[model samples]
Target: MPRRQHITVFAILALFAFIGTSFVLMFRSQPQGADYPGPTSQEPVLVDNEILLGTATAPKLENETLKAELGNAAWKVLHTTMAKFPDKPTEEDSQALKSYIHLFARLYPCGECARHFQQILAKFPPQVATRSTAAAWACHVHNEVNKSLKKDLFDCSKIGDFYDCGCADDGPVKGKEKEKEKDGFKQLELEKEG
Candidate 1:
């Protein structure tokens, strides 16, 4: 065979070898955590209403990356919410945003991540006084999570540059949540219509 053909074949073999090894390591017999299910079930155990898998949902966990992907998506939602917060929120608005974050931490599907988030929230409570302050607070909290994970910290100064909720004039993100935000305010879209 030509040199190029030989190299291609070797690469294919190496890829297969790597995949096989991964499966073996992943499925190998090892003691499960105290919370892990008994041998009869592959499903994860629930602790205090939190699903303790690497990830979870109404749908099944697809892979190891699902947790990180969900985290990314959740962060996008949060950052955008902060961006669209009212410039001078009323007392109700402030309470609503504060309640939302606490509920988010309590109800997040990932047990481990949710617990950590709850702790973080306790340490650094939500700051929802105004749009800039809210957004800045979100950025700071994200950086805190990053620091704990040993991930590179995000640049808080450029958070607005990073997230685009697609709201016009820095408006609220469109969603079911907007129809009835925590304080039961009128829908943002309807307000725009008036």
Candidate 2:
């Protein structure tokens, strides 16, 4: 009787252990944390709705050479605008431009160009002063890149009488005989009146 009771107690413990192990395994199999799914399981950071319009991916301003090129381009654009409307940019425009430059630096990291620009900005300092001008410039560069890419991707139609309706109708008589016939009747009326 004693042996049977000992066996029964051991069996019950074993069953409980099995059940506990199964529960743990089941829990482990399920994903934890926020229920929201992200871009990839490997990507630690997920940016939602941060996609730039007209682009599947951001412009890759990776190397120092590229950075210098972008900087030159941006500077040229800003300078031209400033020249065109001397007082129009104001403090805000300067700040915005500086911000754009900094952004380009971060993306491209042209050491020489960045150093030169930094010194110039420090001495002259654009109208609007920000706490971290360099950092702001970095962000601005990104904005500029995005803006440029968007502009290149999407070309708006000019508002004018001239328009391409995407139809291939050369010399006005390939597909509308009825319309042509109506015009002919108007010409006949004018002739009869004359």
Identify the leading candidate in terms of lDDT: 1
Error of 1 at 72 (Å): 0.9
Which residue pairs come into collision in candidate 2? 99-137, 99-140, 100-140, 100-141, 102-137, 102-138, 103-137, 103-138
Candidate 2 C-alpha lDDT tens digits along 36-111: 6645867665322232111122244458677767666765554333223222345655555545544433333444
Least well predicted 10-residue stretch by lDDT in candidate 1: 185-194
Q: List TM-score per model, in order.
A: 0.54, 0.24
Q: How many steric overlaps does candidate 2 have?
A: 8
Best by TM-score: 1
Candidate 1, residues 48-163, lDDT tens digits: the string is: 32322222123333455988899899998999898778778998898778777777777777767777877877678788777767777788788888999999997676665566
**Root mean square deviation (Cα) for candidate 1:** 17.5
| Clashes per model (N, Cα, C within 3 A) | 0, 8
RMSD of each: 17.5, 20.0
